[model samples]
Target: MRTLKQALLALLVLSSAVADLPTEMPIPEAFIGSPVGTASL
Candidate 1:
């Protein structure tokens, strides 16, 4: 149980760290051409 908790904590920290990194992937032209608020929920 303790190991499971530790693993979850580590995963959470790593996920947050990765989320903070800048996205290197290119944005599709369709997404760029789409007007703002067109896809908003």
Candidate 2:
């Protein structure tokens, strides 16, 4: 459970970092199954 939480946090941080890097940034396989929402809250 702890590892999963850490992985989620890591993925979130990684995604934000990637999003800021550029539009052409590549996502690693570790982020493949992560959930994404179409609606912005």
Each model's backbone clash number: 0, 0
The C-alpha stretches of model 2 lying farther than 4 A from their native spots are 24-41
Candidate 2 positional error at 10, Å = 0.2
The candidate maximizing TM-score is: 2
TM of each candidate vs. truth: 0.53, 0.54
Q: Which residue pairs in candidate 1 have backbone atoms (N, alpha carbon, C) closer than 3 angstroms, thus clashing?
A: none
Colliding pairs, model 2: none
User: Which of the numbered candidates is closest to the native, going by highest lDDT?
Assistant: 2
lDDT of each: 0.48, 0.53
lDDT per residue, candidate 2, 1-41, as tens digits?
99688667766776776676556544543244334311111
